[model samples]
Target: MARQQFDLIVFDWDGTLMDSTAHITRSIQAACRDLSVPVPTDEAASYVIGLGLRDALAIAAPSLDPHDYPRLAERYRHHFLLTGVETVLFEGVRELLEELRDRGYLLAVATGKSRVGLNRALDEVQLTRFFDGTRCADETFSKPHPAMLQELTRELGQDLGRTLMIGDTTHDLQMAINAGAAGVAVAYGAHPVDALTALAPRFVAENVPALRHWLREYA
Candidate 1:
């Protein structure tokens, strides 16, 4: 296909690129436990994977006082940063990114992770060079908000209509819609397949290879 559409391809971190859903879910639960707050079920915890940390904690632990959000957030980070609970990129993720970059597609990240978190992960994986620009929740509006996409497009000199957002959650799709851009969903990530489908993304890939195939033929 000769790259017929989309000049910029934006991705979400955590569940989308990294196999960190379980780690994140566990961390959130552990944070709640540490605070002696009601712990969210596995599903409940995982559903907030693509949202900013505070927003996700609020939804996962609605009973917690707002003043304690920082404490919960700190506990969550502490749990996540522990050695055994670490996360890694999905199989073929690095290769897919390399291929896309070589194909001359402008790659970027619009993730719920804070700038420090995303930077650390990218540098640790040595994948930081693949992205031309990146946006984190702490520096701007979080997922499902158009500000990140809007700013990325403007900074990269790309058109919104020619931008593509790829992620594993509905928040990612809604952000694409709000930004007037197209979206592609991956079923292997955080949100359920059904939730992502309801947004009517351009395509829903089942896994990393399938996603690679889609991009090779259509992206």
Candidate 2:
């Protein structure tokens, strides 16, 4: 394997590492129903997966009143927390993260989830220990803005050239671009591969196993 090219590996949580797209979509729909607003289609809901919750909700259900955003967000969270939703990390994800950590790479998460939501999910999945740091959208600017990645790199003292962001959406790739960091896009996520490819990521992996291989060989 080639020597690691990145010292810090920043990951996007949903659709990239965790298979939570379905759960999130359902939650958005439920929130719309709760507010008596027109629900967005699954594709529409999933399209906003990498954005901050309020921003996502606004885009997904544009007809909804801004005054109802808090309730909409609350209902979404309520539905997401319901039992049996079964949000889990993609297969091989834990192993991949562990291997990267053991190989002396610093791992972190830059997510659109709120701090409370991210913490709960991390605790639930037992993945908190794997990350050296985390930045959440509620605590900073949302994706495509680069504030989250900027903060992560600044806090970790990592150079932009030696930082890599891996995610499953154009928003993620754009965030990397905005941060001046390299990115790898994963296909089996919210955005289609073609859309992600247009952003010119260093590589596009079709699955978790392929992503692992790419990181091993080049990242």
Candidate 3:
């Protein structure tokens, strides 16, 4: 076997692992509507999928006062939870994770979800055991800030240079750049393929199978 290039594999939650991009975007739009704030278009709403809820709401509803953020967030959660059960991991994600685990790689998740929400999702999908460590937006700085990856590396005893961050959005790629980790992008997610490609990640995968294949050969 070839030597592994990375020791720690960090994944972004929404668009990367779980197929929750549309649900989240709808929830954000619904929350904006509930607040009587102008609803963001699907593109505008989906663009914020990998950001912390607070940060996402701020971008999706910039016309609203900061004081109403909590209310907007509440509405967002309410709508999200209503359809949360519909979310699922992308095809082949389980097989990929299991293979990685069997091959002795440390796997972790760096997500925009609150700790509570991430736990719920993990529990719902029964995927908690596959991850060695997890970081939530509510617990620290969100994506595009290196804090999540930095903290995960510290917690897992992995080198920044030997870490691989994979996701569907530019935020994930930018975070890897900020953390000095390599990044892989997936096109079938919240951001457009062109946007993800512009980040110059190690590779841009078009689907879960392609991502899995690449990781098998290179991760």
What tens-digit string does per-residue lDDT give for candidate 1 at 1-219?
Answer: 378888999999888899999999999999999999999999999999888888999999999999999999999999999975555899999999999998999999999999999999998889889999999989999889999999999999999999999999999999999999999999998889999999999999999999999989887
Candidate 1 residue pairs in backbone clash: none
lDDT of each: 0.93, 0.92, 0.93
Q: Which tens-of-lDDT digit does each residue in 1-219 have in candidate 3?
A: 454799999999998999989999989999999999999999999999889999999999999999999999999989999842576899988998998899889999999999999998899889999999999999999999999999999998999999999999989999999999999999989999899888899999989889988998998
> What are the TM-scores, per candidate, against the unseen true structure?
0.98, 0.97, 0.98
Question: Against the true structure, what is every candidate's RMSD?
Answer: 0.9, 1.1, 1.0
**TM match of model 3 to true structure:** 0.98
Sorted on lDDT, best first, the list reads 1, 3, 2
lDDT of 2 by residue, 142-203 (tens): 99998988899899998888999999999999999999999999999999888999999999
Q: State in Å the error of residue 6, model 2.
A: 1.0
